[model samples]
Target chain A: MSPAKHPQRPGGRSARVRDAVYTAVGQLMGEGRPDRLTIPMVAQRAEVNPTSVYRRWGDIDTLLEEVSVAALTREGDEPPDTGSISGDLTQWAQIIVDDITRPQRTRYLRAMVSAREAVESCPCWEQRRGQAKDMLARGIERGEVAPTEHQVLDHVIAPLYHHVVFGLPTDRAYAERLVGDVLAMARPADKA
Target chain B: MSPAKHPQRPGGRSARVRDAVYTAVGQLMGEGRPDRLTIPMVAQRAEVNPTSVYRRWGDIDTLLEEVSVAALTREGDEPPDTGSISGDLTQWAQIIVDDITRPQRTRYLRAMVSAREAVESCPCWEQRRGQAKDMLARGIERGEVAPTEHQVLDHVIAPLYHHVVFGLPTDRAYAERLVGDVLAMARPADKA
Candidate 1:
């Protein structure tokens, strides 16, 4: 027998379930014990059948990875374009510092790192690299000399994440300093 | 009655037990499933009573932290003194990359980081800072411009660790580039 025809709906049941599961995971992560997060707990909080979550994500680690990637690389988020590379990077760095230093976000970041196996690539880092590439391209178009995206990742992003992971002070001032250091790399001989 | 006077032998029973426990932890971590590590498992591997392990270290996480710190900051280890800051940094960075990139060492590092709760001051970082300070002092005495110890940590050490934690490539060439970049920060205006 043929199935009954139905109109395709935007934000359908699947999308609604995904959003609920994501929100539940965020709440569990926000509770500051990512170690205790489990699929059943997420499913219960998400108000979906446990089988549905298991069928969708398969495991808690996969769920955490997906939620963390979404939280870290907010959809449609744009890098700051402040006319100058230094200003743009400074603002961007500050934004990162502020976001990751929050207790819940810190827990989420750490959970993501901890849950990871020996992987060749990190989606969050790749997203940041793409953003950095866009920012650098804009700076170059504006006739400003700039460090490569890798330089920005290694110098600015790496240090920030390092500090966050290691419980170091990740204040706005530290973010500004990291931005200044990377910018200084683009013009070395001027001061020497 | 007075206790019998035994010669206080260095590397005595207590030391031997600690060494065994540390070795066991290292071996378990090397197996690539840090989440499966338990005090009883470590005790069984160390051939020590589980009670003894519990009484001494209290928990697996604490034991992991101690073992990681000892392994990461080798006993009596010294930073390279290559007679120039650049050379010293390059050598030191390479040593770090080589040590931390080993599968076992990488697992140990990730275990340590994953076991951590939010707290101020990482002992391993403080030890590196001390080493960097000594290296910087020698460079200043040699009349070579040098970035501050904090700068060295933020640039070289932080990035290396960040890469290790994130499953990024951490090789000798990457280490050398990081050293070069940090040194360049010490002389910014000379390029333009």
Candidate 2:
């Protein structure tokens, strides 16, 4: 047999382990405690052996690192460029309503919250998050975004996350409203 | 002594136990399995009876919850508004930078990640998140924002969070650049 027996997914054995652990971690995070997340518990739920789990991730935080990366892969949809920046962003902003209400999104968010509590300095956590930021930055470079696009990104969406992860009433309608309001204020003025 | 002793800091009877257990839990989350977080391990490090630990928080999950909240409180800073949207958002975005870089923010994030793994359908989680959205909506009504704010809120700011909580490399310079870029695009236009 090959060194790794498990079937490969998007990123291969490492990916599968990451995916399984994230799924398991997502489930545990929903429960609200690290105590309930035993190796046997994850192995049983993931359909892998405890030995397999240990051989793969070795520990809960390591496993969670994998899980966090997987969560980053899933988020708001890309907006189709409608020739205008406002139109494109308006469409894009609407995507969060869909992202937040989904079951998996909530699970991913909770896991992130719980992980932030224990390991005060974790590189894995930063690496995965970096991917998403790079993705957004790439989008901005391709458009006419403001000088403070990053702040706009921060102020506008941080609350949505605060709402979503914390069990607040964030939804699609709110995202749409936020986008519209900001767009109105952000519209380029015509020269007098 | 009373049926339950409210643990005091510095040299209280339960203080040592609380500190030890809390530290152990943090270490285990970094070095062990989430489910393997047993009371015995906590008690051993705490030097208090396992029974005492159980009496205080009922189980590991409950203990983690309280600790997670406390840890997050320490990582938080009040958002300062500098009047104009430009100044206000600039300050607001930096807070995210500050929070993400703080060591406690990382630990708090880890715990949230673990908890999300256990319970995907936590009602309480949903409720807390809703309040944040409500705050944004209230901001809109207060005219603290222009009418079409949500789109910018959702599209621009949402991504910053992915960067911050994930420990990505988004910074104030990026925030300033984005803010100007988006605000330039947000100005309302006159109809011919």
Candidate 3:
């Protein structure tokens, strides 16, 4: 996984432990020996005391789950409001295209994807997705987009994700092409 | 990462060694420790002796590269002609949807994806993509599809990959909705 999972969220004592635990796990992952990983080992590295660590995270699986959520929830680029869904989607998707294209971020992105499948219920993923949906919603509110097509996330974003998963280029030109295809499909049936 | 990286390619002496190594790696991947994996360990497990394994594979990355090609190349589903590109695509995608949805295979699929990004060439990926492209080409030849818009893989397949990556259900109904979306996007401007 990439070193940077999420933008650090501000918090108090509990957040500090979470951050420490995050560091500990990140270091261990870098070392590359999950099989040898133990809760105590993480606790030792985090300097958080074993009992608290165990109390907070029951097992490795839960710990990883939380970490994944944290990573995905970190601050990210917001969807553009170019006053049109097509314009907004292109700009927004390009941000993601750029983000995932980064070698380091791509690793974390892939890690987050796999980690998401390991269990269930990642609020960060939901939050991220919600933002995408909101862009479509905004378009619909202005009547620039059909209400039926307001749920455009699956169409535009999914293709970008596919490129990322396959190690294919998700550059500006690629994003532009994909967005164009989607927009072509998005054109009013009578207008095309 | 997945055991069944390739369909067993028919050959002679070296093929046997490849098969043995394949089995050994498969068993290791089953235990879930690609990071901890060593060439000598694989060699011992395959009973091919360290020298031969070292001489052939040289390193874990190269060894894994070969294994991935094989796993991806493994004889699997065939894309049905189905008389129409849409029909053929629906059928073909459903097979992938089914293959990936299986709990056990999903693990291997994820591993294969991660391993894929770690290297350069993966012929198996190309092969699967070729099949998708073939469906579009066939549609164009039949004049059932626009020759100008044969590149349907990115739009259609990407959404399916999104579903697969997210561990979402890819039932027949879901497949139809996604396919319908793509078709809608594909429709000529006159047909609303």
Candidate 4:
């Protein structure tokens, strides 16, 4: 197994360096797909010694993992749920649309993709995607979604990452409409 | 730009070389993700000289562009309209699920990702995804999908690619159920 990856500490001399590296990596990812990301450029962008950045993250792949986790984790408060499927989904969809449209989130997605490729055996995406599944499950329990809700989680919310990372624009209104449509589609086949 | 990618070819030696190279690239993609793929192994698989393969394709990235085009083109046989949203989506979703679940398709996704990263400034993915979009659009036009269709296209269909390409064991049933749920969710807010 690969050695466990850790972030540079978030304070003092190390924090300054870590911030620079991540910021640089984000810029590179925003400008191009993950394959084009280079350590030299990342070091240049972050204003850290190339060797130091490499030593800390080990390679582009690991650096990307940190960036992706940070990106998903950094998004601000979710909109309040309206206690109805349409309201809940509309709010969630809008949040996703906003996140992907931001330059940083797309970059993080590209990086996470590279990391997934680099680590062939690990199921690292679960950490990133699990929260979403849990949220959908909550909706299911509240009767806002079907009991068998994993499919909705898999099909709808997750696809936004693929689109954003690939540099596609996913609009907000379209997102809301889709949420409404999907919730409707999931109704039991027998119920009209 | 970039010598006009995938320009139409005259028949003979160039065609033969192109065929051999793409087949080799596709085979390697079928085997595993990009990190695990090697040029020499692709050469061996194609039964062509390694130098010839490299000389012709220039590297894995260019070869991948060709393969991505080929793979995506194979998508979307016409679905029976069946006069209902669920029936149409069920058919289309099944096709996608079945195609992606195959071992070879998994390899192709992994390789295409590597290729996507390596090619710094190409919009090839737009071409690949456009096919799915067009297919979904057709469904929308036929009134087999809801008015807010692109969102459904994004969340439902796009996520399937993410799951399968990332080595998840997703299947057609899962896709159908998700599509169904999304359709249900699409109902007018007041009605829902």
Whole-model Cα lDDT of every candidate shown, in order: 0.82, 0.54, 0.65, 0.61
For model 2, the docking class works out as incorrect
Which numbered prediction scores highest in TM-score against the true structure?
1
**Would candidate 1 be rated incorrect, acceptable, medium or high by CAPRI criteria?**
medium
Greater-DockQ candidate between 2 and 4: 4
* Runs in model 2 lying further than 4 Å from the true structure: A2-96, A108-167, A189-192, B1-44, B48-65, B75-96, B117-161, B175-192
How would you encode candidate 2's per-residue C-alpha lDDT over A20-72 as one tens digit per residue? 76677677656644443567787777766677677766776566766655554
Question: What stretches of model 1 exceed 4 Å from their correct place?
Answer: A1-9, A36-41, A44-62, A188-192, B1-9, B36-62, B188-192
Model 4 misplaced stretches (Cα beyond 4 Å): A1-17, A30-33, A36-60, A77-79, A82-85, A120-152, A166-169, A186-192, B1-21, B24-66, B73-104, B110-156, B166-173, B176-192
Candidates by TM-score, descending order: 1, 3, 4, 2
The 10-residue segment of model 3 chain B with minimum total lDDT is B1-10
The order by descending lDDT is 1, 3, 4, 2
lDDT of 2 by residue, B1-192 (tens): 233356654577676667777777767655544533567787776667788888888876667766655554443434344545556555655665565455545544444444543333433233323433444455556665432344334444554545555455567776665555445544545653
Prediction 1 TM-score vs. true: 0.85
Tens digit per residue, CA lDDT, model 4, A81-168: 5665566566766777887677556545555555554554323355434644555666777866442345445555566556554444
Per-residue lDDT of A1-192 in model 1, one digit per residue for the tens?
121133135577677778999999888888876664788899899988888788778888778877888998774579998898999899899888888988888889777767767345677888899999999999999988899899999999999998887677789999999998998888726433
> Of models 1 and 2, which has the larger DockQ?
1
TM-score of chain A of each: 0.87, 0.61, 0.71, 0.70
Q: Is candidate 1 or candidate 2 better by lDDT?
A: 1
